[model samples]
Target: MASAVSENPFGRSITTEDIVDTLGFFDSWEDRYKYIIDLGKELPAMPDELKTEDRLIRGCQSQVWLEPSEQDGYFEFQADSDAFIVKGLLGVILSAYNHKRAGEILDFDIDSYFDELDLMRHLSPTRGNGLRAMVQRIREIAGE
Candidate 1:
């Protein structure tokens, strides 16, 4: 695994730089979707043990599990979902916030980032709501 430095000037685990780099690699939203799905493939699968009640994310139509761990003073997240789109959304969240301190992740300007990417407006209402739920669950884990 490629390790990112723990302290980032941007105060985000995954910077706008990372997202820009990712976007540059794909030619179209279809290709981007493929890349996003591929990112989901890279997520460490949530353990069956962690799939109990405590890890479940509320407000999601699918069964979503998120397990957070702190290593080397950085928070790392492992997540999974039974639904494909939810899995992809989890990938998006992980790409942005995994491997950061709780404070940094909590401080990240996520709405601005999503607006810059033109993401939420393009999504269906349900998917957008589910995305917000995912972010909320992660933020809650960060204790924000």
Candidate 2:
């Protein structure tokens, strides 16, 4: 999966650098939605076993599943949801922290990232809260 990211320059790898790069490209929420959905398409499928009750994200209006595994020094994630926009939001998040160390993920300025992308203001209240819940869940997993 990492190799796939390396192969496509336009398909930004799940990294902070890529997120910064992506926010620079899209000019509006509509364009950003297209970009985010494209990111979701790039996500590797979540394993069926990892999609169980324990991995479910709470506070989400839609069913969301997220699983994290640490390999070497980084955390690898697998996530999915029944809702399309939520899936896309998960993709946006994975782009920022997937395959990165817990400390790094914790250190990221998520609010700044959202502000730069102009994301939360445009999202519905429920979706915005879901996004916060997702981040909080990941932070708890990181023990940060």
Q: Candidate 2: list runs displaced more than 4 Å.
A: 1-12
Clashes of each: 0, 0
Q: Which stretches of candidate 1 lie over 4 Å from their true place?
A: 1-16, 25-27
Q: What tens digits encode model 1's per-residue C-alpha lDDT throughout 6-112?
A: 67333445445576578678767877777667767766677788898888888887888888887766778889988776787787778767877788788888887
> Ten residues in a row with the worst lDDT in model 2?
1-10
Global local distance difference test of model 2: 0.77
TM-score, prediction 1: 0.81
Per-model lDDT: 0.75, 0.77
